[model samples]
Target: MLIYTGGTFGMVYDEDGSLAPFNFSLVIEKIPELQSLDLKLTVISFPDPVDSSNVDIEHWQAMAYIIKDHYEQYDAFVILHGTDTMAYTASALSFMFRGINKPIILTGAQIPIGATRSDARENLITALEIASTKNGKVPMLNEIAVYFNYYLLKGNRSQKIRSSNFAAFESENFPYLAESGVKIVFNESFMNTHDPQQKLEFYPKMDPNVVVLKIFPGITEEVVKSILNIKGLKGVVIESYGSGNIMSWRWMEELLRDAVSRGIFLYNVSQCMGGSVVQGRYETSKMLSDIGVISGHDITTEAALAKLMHLLGTERNVDIIKQKLNVSIRGELTVV
Candidate 1:
């Protein structure tokens, strides 16, 4: 089954020349090439269009419930979504539908489907092909993934690295599952699979008591102090500099200690792409280790944020959440 969550791919020009969502029922008509493919296709769309930026816990819950309600009937699913927060939703879904054995591929276009030079048709076509891909009876891909610009990337490992280019997403910490070209190349050695016998677990919502802090040079004590002081905040994902380095100061140490003492889970991630966070490798980051900060170890900021919200939402104990964040769940981070 194919689900449309509303994006540029479903838009067309209105009578006044303004962009608007068109009837998704016309999808097969708009892209007639699907007629040649041998697959049973079903299209379902959200009642209202949602800009990816507006997606929140409720949207995630709704999406999970929708998929769960139809899980038994469909062989696989292709979700057409907006690109702006694709990584965020992908990461969240990876946690929401743990142990899901069916392929859940999320895809979107850089340009609208109605535009003269749109990239939607090829993306949608390839996504459907990948969803239907099978070795005998079991699908080749059984995890949540994002297919874009000829690359099939692990959803939690992806980040939106560009806005203007057709290649808008990349998997910096992990290799892609497959690449489309003259022939689709599957990286079999690097691919991950789900246990078909294991039951799928569903998490409908995430805890909203989380915040992300991006560290910058010369950040004032007042700024950090205010951020760490958010009312009832349980989790914080700190985007630190190279190798998770941050300013070393007594006040900063005191604040972090206070937060930990108050049972807040702290995680450190590198702002640089392809860089791993090693807590005690440098003088600046060594203090983080001393104060019990959890190392994110090469996780993207998007995944870090989602994992934090997921853990805090499902597991209440701060210590258990700290341990789980340090371990790999759904391949979001490299635990060292």
Candidate 2:
């Protein structure tokens, strides 16, 4: 199954020369190589294409529902998404679909398919091949992943680090699952495998009452208070400095402590692209640990936020949510 969400990958030059989404019905005409793959193809597109920036909880739920409704029919699934929030979507889906026995590959392009120099054709083609590949009768990739610029990154581990470049996504803390060159090479040691007998579980609910607060030097108390005090806020993903350290400010500490007391889950994540959050490793971060702020370990801010929402939406117990936050529910973070 090929699912097309709005992105540069599906765009083409309109009659006036402006870029617009083209009909996927003619996708084979645009890229003739798909016919050579000799696989049954089915295309499902959003009713109205949406830019990635506009992606929200509703959009994520819709994607999850589509996969759940058709989980049995397809051997694998491919999602063409916008690069801007592709990592977030991938992360959310990874959590939503638990113990999935088949591959769910997400890919998009930096340029439109209509352009002569576009990278869309190769990205789409390779993503499909990887999704369909198997080890004997078992699927080669049993987890959600992002395939871009010749690298296949675990969905929850990926981050979009580049805006204008073809190599837009990276998995800083984890190794690539596979790499595409003359031939696709699988890094089986790093890739996730699942039991074929395990049934696929779909989590459709995701709470959006979460915010990402990135701490920086000289940030005022008012800014901190207003965010922590947001009405109905259930969770906050704090992007702290090196090793999850934040300035030892009395006001900030008091505010965080108060939020914890109010039952708002505080998750500490690292601001660095390539390191884990080691709360209490430094004196500054020791306050966070003392205040009951859960360490996010090596989870990306995108994945942290998505995981928070997923947990909050599904679990009613605060203690259970905190426990899940400290562990890797769907390989989104390292426990250590």
Q: Which number leads on lDDT?
A: 2
Sequence-dependent TM-score of model 2: 0.99
What lDDT tens digits, residue by residue, belong to model 2 across residues 60-170? Answer: 999999999999999999999999999999999998888899999999999999999999999999999999898898899999999999999999999999998999999
Q: Which residue window of length 10 is worst by lDDT in model 2?
A: 191-200
**Poorly placed runs, candidate 2 (over 4 Å):** none
Candidate 1 local lDDT, 137-191, one digit each (tens): 7888888999999999999999999999999999988998999998778786776
Instruction: Report the Cα lDDT for residue 155, model 1.
Output: 94
TM-score of each: 0.98, 0.99
- How does residue 87 of candidate 1 score in lDDT? 94
Residue-level lDDT for 243 in candidate 2: 89
